[model samples]
Target: MRVLVAPDKFAGTLTAVEAAEAIAAGWRRHAPDDELDLAPMSDGGPGFVDVLHATLGGELLVTTVEGPHGEEVPATVLHVGDVAYVESAQAIGRHLVTEGGAEFATTVGAGELLLAALGTGATTVIVGLGGSGTNDGGAGLLDALGAVADAGQLDGGPVLFAGLSSVDLAPARAKVAGVRLVAATDVDNPLTGLFGATKTYGPQKGIAEDRLYEVDGWLEQLAEATDRRTSLVKGAGAAGGLGHALLCLGAVREPGIALVAEAVGLASRARAADLVVTGEGAFDFSSRSGKVPYGVAEIAAEALRPCIAMAGQVLVGSREMRALGVENAYSLVDLVGEQRAFEDPVGSLQALGERVARQWSRE
Candidate 1:
């Protein structure tokens, strides 16, 4: 049997490439004679650039940029023929911010990386938006791109936006006037409301529950200072409102997984495989929202192949899993417990892969 192993990054534990390798290794252990194909995936999150680079063979331009906490960090941009690709998480990933620092995290580095991509003379720039720690409604990003605001206001967090006086986005808009900016995102939430960036993602980034509305209001003020209409656009809330900023610059939104799937030729691979396996850090109902697992399973289903998922945790019931197009789902935590799953994610994931292969592998 031919098995296609594809997975997104295991959050903090592994990159998509590493996850694919680990799962493939385990599958080989159980079914050495079975052919295996590895196609790691990303939904415009942390491994976005790397996955694209691996499959597209693009030029990787490395540069130093501001991190979530105003620190310097390394990031990479993938430049292909006439387009450039960047991952927002490389600059503002949730893991880069410490507890209680989410309120102050900035997307400045992401803007800087965008500038670098622009410097490459690419006409089309695709920004992968997800796993962000900042909640400043992309003020830092606008500031980095020459959108002038009150001195020091756009440099800090949303808390500082309360006193924001004025914003001039002309220069930023002019910079990308003729360029095509695409916001590749996994989410479709608007910028500032109940289902928006702050209320939905701020808690995970360390914002207190009571502060959700307050922080969201700050983002609203940011939208008011710029383009209020763009704030309500789908995906405006992705990457801590980085999506909103890009949209403000006239960017169109695209489902990141769809973009990734096309770049990786996932459909053709699935068509050639007898079985497909895909996963991520967590598998739940939310997976249906353009995540890698759901996207991969969809492709597998289109190919009329059986699809299964192996993840760090499986929160969806079997019926829900089937609804996502996954024939079955396996959890590392369920197989080896939570403590071991985190302490030794690669090993635990490999073990889970082996167990799943035993049941699914046609030996």
Candidate 2:
């Protein structure tokens, strides 16, 4: 039996690579003769560069950039040939905002990371956008790239954007004149309104529920100060309006998972495997979106292979799981208690993998 183990990062617990290794370890314990192919994936979030570096074998350039709160943070840029990959989450991810709300988080560090990628002499820069802890409409990013604002420093987040008089993106635009910029995003939400950055993702980054509209209005105001049209573009809301900033600079938007799948040759791998296993932190209806599990399952279906999932938690019904092209889904929280799953995620997932192998592996 041959199994293809591919999974996205399990949120706060394990990275996709770690998750794949854990599953493979347990599967090997149960079915020692079975072949296991580990292919970790990402959807332009935290593990974007790591996964790409693993499969693409790029030059990982380490650098220091501003964190969401203006502190210096370590970041890496994956340089492969003439293309560079930058993960926005490395600078402004939700996990980095330890003390403040989204209202004060900045995307300035992301801009710095982009500059680093550009410094690599890469003709193409792909900015992976998701897991952000900001809602500043990319003001900080523009500032980092030399965009000037009349009234604000641009690194203080959305609250400061409310006082902006005007913004000049010309200088910043000139910086990336000949380079091709790509916004690899997970969501297609615009920069402002109900589905916008502040409203949809602000709460998770610590925006008070009552202040959603207020912060959203600030981003709207920032957009008006700059380019309102770019604010309405799909994926503009990604990474707390960082996508809008990238769009303003003439970036093309593409699904992160799709980019990753193509880079990893996922379709060909699925066709070679007898069974495909994919997963994430939670297996829910939202998995139907451009997530790793759904994307992998689709490829598995096209290859006429059975696809199953192993997640931290299974929040969707069996029918919905099947609709996503997964034969079945396993959950660490379901097999072991939630405490145990969180306490020792690697071991818990390895155990879950062994159990799933018993049912799926023909050994």
**Model 1, runs deviating above 4 Å:** 150-152
For lDDT, the strongest prediction is 2
Predicted candidate 1 versus true structure: per-residue lDDT over 303-333, tens digit per residue: 9999999899899998899899999889898
Provide the overall lDDT of each model, using Cα atoms, as 2-decimal numbers.
Answer: 0.90, 0.91
TM agreement with the true structure for every prediction: 0.96, 0.98
Stretches of candidate 2 off by over 4 Å are none
Lowest lDDT block of 10, candidate 1: 150-159
